[model samples]
Target: MNGHALVVGEALVDIVRRAGSEPVEHVGGSPLNVALGLGRLGRAVQFVTRVGADERGTRIVEHLTAAGVALTPGSTSADRTATAQAELDEKGSARYEFDITWDPVEPPMTADVVLVHTGSIATVLEPGCDVVAELVALQSRTSTVSFDPNIRPALIADPARGRARIERLVTLADVVKASDEDLEWFAPGRDPLDTAREWLSRGPAVVAVTRGGAGAVAVCAAGTVEVPAVQVEVVDTVGAGDAFTAGLLDGLWSFGFVGIERQERLRDIGTAELRAALETAAWTSALTVARAGADLPTLAERVAARKVTR
Candidate 1:
C-alpha cells in the first residue's frame, strides 16, 4: 500500500429487473463501487457521498464497511436514498432509469490520502458537482487524481454543458477513463481515440477508453497502449468500469505513482507502465462482470482468475 485513497460521489441502491424474475436490490453507484473495489483489493479507502438516513442508505454503508472502506462523516445527508432501476437485456447488458438526488456536502481532506477519484453522475449533477470539481482541483496539486466519466445519457440535461463539465474535470485529473459510448455521446461521430488524444493534450497523463468486449486503449504523452478485454460470461455490465478504475489506481500505486511524493512522476509515465495498468484494469472489470449486480472482485478472486487463464 502506497497511500490512502479518497473517493467522492453518490451511493445508491440498484433495483435490477429481468424477465420472469423479481427485482433485486443491491448497493451501487460508480464511485462507491470504485471505493469498495479498492478496499477489497486491500487498499485503504475512504468514501464520501450522499445517501438518505434510510434502509437503502444503511445497505450501502454496510456494503462499504464489509469491503473495509471507511465512510466519511456527514455522508448520509439526503432526504431519501437514490435508486437506479436497471433493466437487464437478454445478453445481460443493463439499461438504467434513475430516481436520484445529488446534493453532497464538501468532502474533508486528509493529509494521508494520495489518490482522489470521482466521476459519473457526481461530476455533472446539481449543486454537488461543483463541490466535487473543487475537491479534485485542490487534490490534484498534491495527490494523484483519477476520473471516470461513466456518462449516463438519462442524467445529462444538456449535452453541450455535460461535455464542458467532463472536459474541465479531465484537465484536473492525472488519469481519466471513459467508455467508448461516453466519448460518442461527448463528440458525435468522432473516433474515441481522437477524443482520448485530445484529452491527453489538455493535461491528463493517461486517457483511457474502454470498448466493451473490443477491449481498451490508453493515450498518453509517450504513446498509446491497448489491452484486450478478458473473456468472461458477463452477468451484467454493472460496475465493470468502476472496477477497472480501481484496478488502474492500484496498479499505479504499486508502481509508486500514487503518493504526493511521486504524483508528479505520473505525468511522465511510459508505454510499458500504461499497458500494465490497463491489464490490471481489464482483470478487475472482467471479474466484476462475471458475477451479478456490481459485485467487484477481491484480491484473492483476481489472483485465482489470473491463475486459471494461465
Candidate 2:
C-alpha cells in the first residue's frame, strides 16, 4: 500500500507430469508468482515479463489479471510461450525440464513504483538478464530492490558468469532471498549462512535463506533470526519460495520498511520486526505447499490463517 511494485522476469506455463496422469498446465515462473502473490495480498503491482502470443500466453495474462496484477507494456512476445515440463515424484516435489525463451524488450517504468523485484533465470538468462540488472541498478537509488536467485543450474550455460551476475545484483539489492539448494548449487562446500553473510557485506541489508522443511534463517547488520517452518501436508513445492518472497515484501511494507523514505531503515530493523516478517513469509509459503501448483493465498485467507494460529 506504500506504493506500487514492479516485478520483472519470465512468465511460463508449467506442464506437470505425474505418473499415470496427463500433463496438467499451470501458469508459473518464479518472478511471475511473486508478482501474483503480491497482487493477491492487495498490493498495487505490475508484472513485466515475456511470453508468446499464443494460448498459453493469454492464460498467463488472464491469471495475472485475475490476481489483480497489471501487465507492463510489451509483455507479450511474438515467439511461442515458454514451457517447463515438471516430473513429480511420489513426494510431490518436482524435477523440471524447461523449453523457454527469454529475450524481452525493456518496458517503461512507472512513477509510483517504490519497490522493484527480479531474479531467477531472468537475472542470468541473456540479453534480457542484462536489462533486468540495469533496471534494478537504476531503481536501487529510488526504490527498494529485492532479489531472489532461484538458481536453475541446468539452464545456466556458464556457472562462473552466472555467479558473477548474481553477485552484482546482490550488491545493488536491499533484500535478497535464496534457498539452501540455491546456495549449495552456487557455492558448493561453503556454509550457506556464511554465503548469506557474505552477501550482506556486499550490500544487501538482509539476506534470507530458506532451508526447505528445516525452516529459514535471515541475517542482517542487526543480527540473525531463524524461524521454523509451518507444518502442513506437502503438495508440490512449485512457487513456495516465490510466495515467501512476496510475503516478506508485504511484511516489510506493512512495517514501514519499504520505499525511498524507509529504505535506509531496513539495515537496522529490530529483531521482533524481522521475526514477524519471517513468520509472515513462513505462513505464506505454507499456504502454497498446502495447495497444488503455485497457488498463493489472498489477503483475506492470510488474515484468517493468522487468526487460527492465534
- Show model 2 residue runs off by greater than 4 Å: none
Write one digit per residue (lDDT tens) for candidate 2, span 41-111: 99999988998889999999999999999988788864888999999999888899889878877777666
Could you report the Cα RMSD, in angstroms, for every candidate shown?
Answer: 1.1, 0.9
Best by lDDT: 2
Residues 1-310, candidate 1: write the lDDT tens digits.
4568999998899999999999999899999999999999999999989998889888898889999999888898789999999999998888999998888877667788888999999999988888899989988887888999999988999888888999999998889999999999888999989998998899888899999999999998889999999999988898888998888888888887787677568888899998998999999999999999899999999989899889
Instruction: Rate residue 270 of model 1 by lDDT.
Output: 91
Instruction: Enumerate residue pairs that collide in model 1.
Output: none
Candidate-wise lDDT, in order: 0.90, 0.91
Which residue window of length 10 is worst by lDDT in model 2?
103-112
Could you give me the TM-score of model 2 versus the true structure? 0.98
- TM-scores, all candidates, are 0.97, 0.98
